[model samples]
Target: MTDSYRRQIDKLHDDVRRGRLSRRDFMIRSAAIVGAGALPVLPFGARAEEPASGGFMKLGLHNASQNDSLDPGTWSTSWTGASFNGGVFNNLVEILPDGSVAGDLAESWELDSGAKIWRFKLRPGVVFHNGKSLVAEDVRQSLLHHMKPDSTSGARAIVQQIETINADGPETVVITLTEGNADLAYLLSDYHLSIYPALDGGGIDMESGVGTGAFLLESFEPGIATRLKRNPNYHKNGKPYLDEVEFINIPDATARLNALLTGEVDFIQDLDIRNVSLVERSGDFAIVRTPSLRHFTFDMDTRVAPFDNPDVRLALKYALDRQDVIDKVFLGEGAIGNDNPVASIQKYHRDLPAREFSIAKAKDHLAKAGVDTLQIDLSVAENAFAGAIEAATLYQEHAAQAGININVVREAADGYWENVWRKKPFCAVDYFGRATVDWLFATSYVTGAPWNSGWSNAEFDALHKAARAETDEEKRGADYGKMQEILRDDGNVITVAFVSWRDAVSDRVGFGEVGGLMPLDNMRLCERWWLKS
Candidate 1:
């Protein structure tokens, strides 16, 4: 084979290893390059495992809050996502295990020539738990719920781009966008855009929690536990192998680990990296580490004093020893972040220069900011992530070397997302990461977005708008690359590391390839995983 052909094969292999491309896709592309007769033997576990049916599965998850709601727009934590959104409801599109978008509720979709209009054909014969047939109207109204002016949905910025949503008969829905967005389908796969039955009065009935998903909600108690049972009439054939699934909220890492150890739960997400060796030695459990776009951050409100100064923000970024945190807290299982949310595996990821840890540079930036010494309060909770408290303490020590006093405030985990994050000027936060760069930016960085940090720049906003509308691949990539640089240099959020999604599953459970976009197999464990018969 030619050297170029060999390089192409190598690239495909790398993509498969990183979970960015599916094994099936790799085989197809590789066979085309080398004739079918030259194909190599299939590796072990290459074939899909047949899913066994009928058993109970329970998951111990963290970050569940009392403020959790059945309303898709209000759902945030993994507790609600894994129990309700992933099992009890379905989005128009779904991100597959290989990080590709596939039809979920929508059987197929067509984009107009200008890329400004999209038409989705609903999957027929699909019915919600209440026996209501899935229709185009349900999709329109479900999305409209987040587009309302008064809506507080986290997906508001994403849906606001829709100029109109019209139902064409019972099965087809047309969406007109104010501007072209090539990533619209991926954005629709967002958990907050789950389809719900529409009310006769022109709004979606989100409070009911009824959806055309694989499982039905049996009982729910916010911040506590959610119980669900298999949907007898689920559209996905042979799915929801578990007879019942339970998602229990366990904020304490030690308690969650103990529950998994004692067989009280079949699986647990956000596995404490420190305990990986213990689980491995036990032989009763297996670790699923999927590299993801998930990043931990220390957000500073630019509207607040001291942080308002660009030099002060720069100083803080320089003071953070990202490698140290990744080594000590994450057990060196993650990649050091460049203050950018985009992961190296994703499209349009720019390989920006790594920001080195230099106390001298941090002190210099503080001097430039007209401050001899700096002091800041960093609010944190375990709910932010598995080792957020320890990460904060390490940050405090690192900052002290640069003449910065960081007061670490340990807050209660019950209402951390509601009470502390985005409310405090400086605090620790974590994002499960979105499927696309545009979706990630629209959700957390856009001006007027609900989850936006206090920093805003007209230039960055313009680039974002331009990039979203640009259909040219080369130009679009350049625009996105510029945006990453902008965030890295001037943004208020300090991204510490892009960590992998680590979860522990019982040996009794069986599954196929796992998704890396979010924890618990992209929060679809209940439907995709099954017990060993």
Candidate 2:
């Protein structure tokens, strides 16, 4: 083997030896290096115990709105993603615990026509919660739900490249893209792309919440609570050990943590960093800190005044102390951001130099924008994310030094996402981060994208399109790097920090490995985790 491959194997071995990596992860990485059939025999630690079955699991999650809906198109927050998408529905592809992509509903897939056409073979014997067998028509209708002209699905930007989707047979689907995209499979793993049963008339029936997932929705109370039962007919064998699952909406961090400590809930997400020591002292729970792509941002609407000028945007970017936000607000649980959405852990990530805080530079940029001093209102609420209000307060203090008066407007937590987020000129926003670079940029950065920050650049758009279609790794990396530079230098987002997915779990829960891609084990804890007691 080459030296590079040998070094990778050594690292995986060390990670597994130190208990930093699971045995399954070690095997997965090793097989990728030495080929599955050529993998050498090695001691893989102790044999894992079979998962204990038949117990109820309750989770206290942060932030839920009465506006939440069963329709996947309208689903945005983790509240709906965990309860509905992760538990009650399945996507065509899934991001495994090891961060590898694998077929979920589709048993296998192949690319053709210069990677522009994809053929997916559906998994056999899969049936929906209502006893309807999964068919190719179901996948087609479910995907087409987001492609309609007036469809307001969050996934619209990513799926717009599809030229056509045709059911080749009862068990096969053929999708043709307007252009070649090698990362199309990864995009399909998006939570908003959950497959639902097709209606006899047309389109998929999204209101009923009937899906071919590991769980069946029993009750849904919008922002209050959601209840689900194990799917007896689930395709995966010896899975979804929990007999029932409940998700309670607890917007307050203290209340969410209290629910876990009081044994009212088995787990809680977005744990308050200030209480890390208290949880450790209690010893009744264990903290699961997974390195994640989740990042916090201050979004400026480029369409609005003050922010309409690029120099003003640059002045705002230079006014904040990102390190201070990471240290004070996040309690040093995150890395400083460089105004780029792509995380260091992702492929084709560019190591851009950190944007230093400089009052002089900020003043210079403001002067270039024909302003001696600037004042702007920043909308924020506790519902944006943990420590959002505190971060905005610190930012308010930092910008004052640069002659930038920031008015931090505290909005209500109940309907923050629906009311303040994109509607406000400037606001605090957080993204869980998509699986791929293209998915991330397309969802929130591309021109005319629904979640875009009202900033558009023809150069950046060109690079994005070229990179998505390029199959050459070197060429793709270069294109992605240019896009990152463009965003870092001229983007409307002031990225604060990329935080870790810190969650607390009760000792009663059992699981092998956790996924870092999203909170609560990629939001699949309901199905992958089992109750030990």
For TM-score, the strongest prediction is 1
Off by over 4 Å in 1: 1-48
**Which ten residues in a row are the worst by lDDT in model 2?**
39-48
Report the C-alpha lDDT of model 2 over 238-356, residue by residue, as the tens digit.
Answer: 88999999999998999998899999999998889898888878767977666667889999999999888999999999999998988888776677788998987788989888789
Which digits, one per residue and each the tens of the lDDT, describe model 1 over residues 1-533?
A: 56667677777765554345544576678877666335353321222457899999999988788888888887777777778889999998888877789999889999995778999998889998999898888888888889888988888988888999999999999999998887889888888888889999788886777888888888889889989999999888889899999889998888989999999999888888878889979788987666667889999998899999999999999999998998899876777787998887778889899999989999999999999898889999988877889999999999999999999999999999989988999999888888888888888887877788678988889999998888788998999999999999999889998876778888898887777787667778799999988
Residue 349 of model 2: what lDDT?
A: 88
Worst 10 residues of 1 by lDDT: 39-48
Q: Candidate 1, clashing residue pairs?
A: none
Q: RMSD to native for every prediction?
A: 4.1, 5.1
Q: What's the number of clashes in each of the models?
A: 0, 0
TM accuracy, model 2: 0.92
